[model samples]
Structures are given as structure tokens and as C-alpha cells.
Target: MVKLRLKRYGRKGQVTYRIVAMNNLSRRDGKAIEELGFYNPRTNESSLNVANIKRRIEQGAQPTNTVRYILAKANVL
Candidate 1:
């Protein structure tokens, strides 16, 4: 199953996340099928590819709880 999730990156205490489309069984930081957006918790900032996100969701990609919140906050869901 394909899932829309976050992949952690950046330095130890300054971590950021890349929103990604990846296989459900993969590790949290594993390779992804596609990168969909970005998020920074420290600043509550996010940038998304709206078109691709809608496309993937329509094709059966399920977003995780956190991603769902972000999408809703961005008025994309």
C-alpha cells in the first residue's frame, strides 16, 4: 500500500520533514516514491505541491494523521 507520510531530515535538534509518498512497509526515513512537500515544526511552515497531492490521493494514497492535519490546515483537504 502506498502512503503519504513524512521523512525526517536535517540536523539532530533542528529536524525538518519531507512529505513523501512511500510504501507503507518501509522505514520512516526510507526511500520514497515521490516527494510531495515539506514541513518545519519549529516554524510551523509547510510548502506543498497541491496538484500532485490531489492526484496521489485520488489514486489511493492515504495520508497519515499528521499529514491530514497539515492538509486541512492548508485547506487542501
Candidate 2:
């Protein structure tokens, strides 16, 4: 199963995330098929590639709960 999920990165206490498409069996920070966007919680900021996201979702990629929240906030889903 492929999924739309967040990949944690950046320094401790100042983490950020990359939105990506990957296999469900992959680890949290494992390889992804493609990057779709970015989210920075500390700054409450996010930038997304809506077209890519829609394409992925249409291809049967389910979004993780947190990713779903991000998409909701971005009005992408």
C-alpha cells in the first residue's frame, strides 16, 4: 500500500517535515517515491504541491492522520 505521509527532518527541537509518497512498510524516515510538500510546525507554515497530491490520492495513496490534518488546513483535500 502506498501512502501520503510526513518524513521528519531538521535538528532536534526544531523539526520540520516533508510530505511524501512511499510504501506502507517503509520506516518513518525511509525512502520515498516522491516529495509533495513541506510543513514546519514550529512556524505553523506549510507549502504544498496540490496537483501532485491530488494525483497521488487518485492513484490510491492514503494520507496519514497528521498528513490529512495538514491537507485539511491547506484545503487540498
Candidate 3:
């Protein structure tokens, strides 16, 4: 199954994340099928690729709870 989830990155205390389309069984920071957006918690900032995200969602990419929240905040759903 494919899922839309966050891929962790950055330094220890300043981690940022990339929203990606990935396989369900992969690790949190594993390889991604495609990068759809970005999230920076420290600044509450999100950068989204609307067309790609919408296409993936239409193709059955399930977002994690956190990703869902972020998307809602961005009004991308």
C-alpha cells in the first residue's frame, strides 16, 4: 500500500519534514516515491505541490494523521 507521510530530516533539535508519497511498510525516513511538499514546525510553515498531492490522493495515497492535520491547515484537501 502507498501512503502520504512525513520524511524526517535536518539537525537533532531542529528537524524539518518533507511530505512524500511512500510505501506503507517503509521506515519513517526511507526512500520516497515522490516529494509532494514540505513542513517546518518551528516556523509553522508548509509548502505544498497542490497538483501532485491531489493526483496522489486521487490515486489512493492515505495520509498519516499528522499529515492530514497539516494538509487541513493548508486547506489542501
Candidate 4:
């Protein structure tokens, strides 16, 4: 199974995330099949690759709850 999820990064208190597609059994920060977007909680900012995301979703990539919410906000799902 493949999943769409967040990969944490940045300094300790200031975290940012990359929206990624990876195998379901992999570590959260492990290798990803593709990086589809970015999100910054502090600034509430997001950048998405909508076309790719939609393609992945249609191919059975399941988003985590948080990622799902983010995608919904972007109107991609």
C-alpha cells in the first residue's frame, strides 16, 4: 500500500513538512516515491501539486488524516 503523508523537517521548534508519497510500511521520514507539496504549520501556508496529487489518489494512494484535511482545504479531494 502507498500512503500520502507528511515528512517532518526544519529546526526543533519551527517545523515544516513535505507532503509525500511512500510505501505504507516505511518510516515516516524514509524514502518517498514522490514529493507532492509542502506545508508550514506556523504560517498556515501550503503548496501543492494538484495534478500529481489527484493522479496518486486515483491510483489508490491513501492520505493520512492530517494530509487528507490539508488536501481537502486545497479542494483536491
Candidate 5:
């Protein structure tokens, strides 16, 4: 199964996330099939590849809960 989820990055206490399409069994921060966007919690900033995200979702990628909220906030859901 493929899932749309966050990939952790950056240093301690200042972590950032990349919204990526990855296999369900893959470890967090493992290889991604594609990087769809990013989120910076410290700044509450996000950037998305809307078209690609839609496509992936249409193709059966399930977004995690946090990603779903972010997408809703962006009005992309």
C-alpha cells in the first residue's frame, strides 16, 4: 500500500517535514516515491504540488491524518 505521509528532516528541536508518497511499510524518513510538498511547523508554512497530490490521491494514496488537516487548511481537500 502507498501512503501520503511526512518525512522528517532538519536538526533537533527544529525539525521540518517533507510531504512524500511512500510505501506503507517503509520506515519514517526512508526513501520516498515522490516528494509532493513540505511543511515547516516552526513557521506554520507549507508548500504543495497540488496537481500531483490530487493525482496521487486519485490513484489510491491515502494521506495521513496530519496531512489531511494540512490539505484542508490549504483548501485542497
Candidate 6:
């Protein structure tokens, strides 16, 4: 299954995340089919590719719980 999920990056204690589309069995930081957005908890900032996200979701990519919340906040779902 393909899933839309977060890929952790940035430095320790200052983490950021890239919203990604990848196979469910892939490694957390493995290669992703596409990058759809970014999030930074420290600043509560987010940038998203809404069109792509909707397209992906319609095409059957499932978001992780956290990603789902972000999408909801962005009113994408």
C-alpha cells in the first residue's frame, strides 16, 4: 500500500518534517515517490501542495494519523 506520511529531518531537538508519499513498507527516511509539503512544530508553520495532496488521496494514498490532522487543518480533507 502507498501512504502519505511524515519523513523526519532537521537537527535533534529542532525537528522538521517533510510530507511524503511512499510505499508502506519503506523505511521512514527512505526514498519517497513525491514530496507534498513541510511542517515545523517549533514555529507551527506549514506549507502544502494542496492540489497534489488531494490528487494523491483520491488516487488511494492513505495519510498517517498525524498527516491526516495536518490535512484536516489545511481543509484538504
Each candidate's number of clashing pairs is 0, 0, 0, 0, 0, 0
Q: Provide the lDDT at 7 for model 6.
A: 98
Local distance difference test, each candidate: 0.98, 0.97, 0.95, 0.97, 0.98, 0.96
Evaluate model 4: give its TM-score.
0.98
For model 1 the TM-score comes to 0.99
Off by over 4 Å in 4: none
Q: What digit string (tens of lDDT, one per residue) describes model 5 on residues 1-77?
A: 99999999999999999999999999998999999999999999999999999999999999999999999999999
Worst 10 residues of 4 by lDDT: 68-77
| Runs of candidate 1 exceeding 4 Å displacement | none
- Please, what are the lDDT tens digits per residue for candidate 4 over residues 1-77? 99999999999999999999999999989999999999999999999999999999999999999999999998988
Residue 10, model 5, lDDT: 98
Candidate 2 weakest lDDT stretch, 10 residues: 68-77
> By lDDT, highest first, what's the ranking?
1, 5, 4, 2, 6, 3
Q: After superposing candidate 3 on the true structure, give the runs of residues whose Cα lies further than 4 Å from its correct spot.
A: none
- Model 2: runs farther than 4 Å from truth? none
Report the Cα lDDT for residue 1, model 6. Answer: 92
Q: Write the per-residue lDDT of candidate 2 for residues 1-77, one digit (tens) a residue.
A: 99999999999999999999999999999999999999999999999999999999999999999999999999999
Q: Record all residue pairs in model 6 with backbone atoms less than 3 Å apart, i.e. clashing.
A: none
Give the per-residue lDDT of model 3 (tens digit) for 1-77: 99999999999999999999999999999999999999999999999999999999999999999999999998987
| Clashes (candidate 4) | 0
Give one digit per residue, the lDDT tens place, for model 1 in 1-77.
99999999999999999999999999999989999999999999999999999999999999999999999999999
Candidate 3 weakest ten by summed lDDT: 68-77
Candidate 1's clash total is 0
Question: What lDDT is reached at residue 39 by model 5?
Answer: 99
The lDDT of model 4 is 0.97
- Regions of candidate 6 where Cα sits further than 4 Å from its true position: none
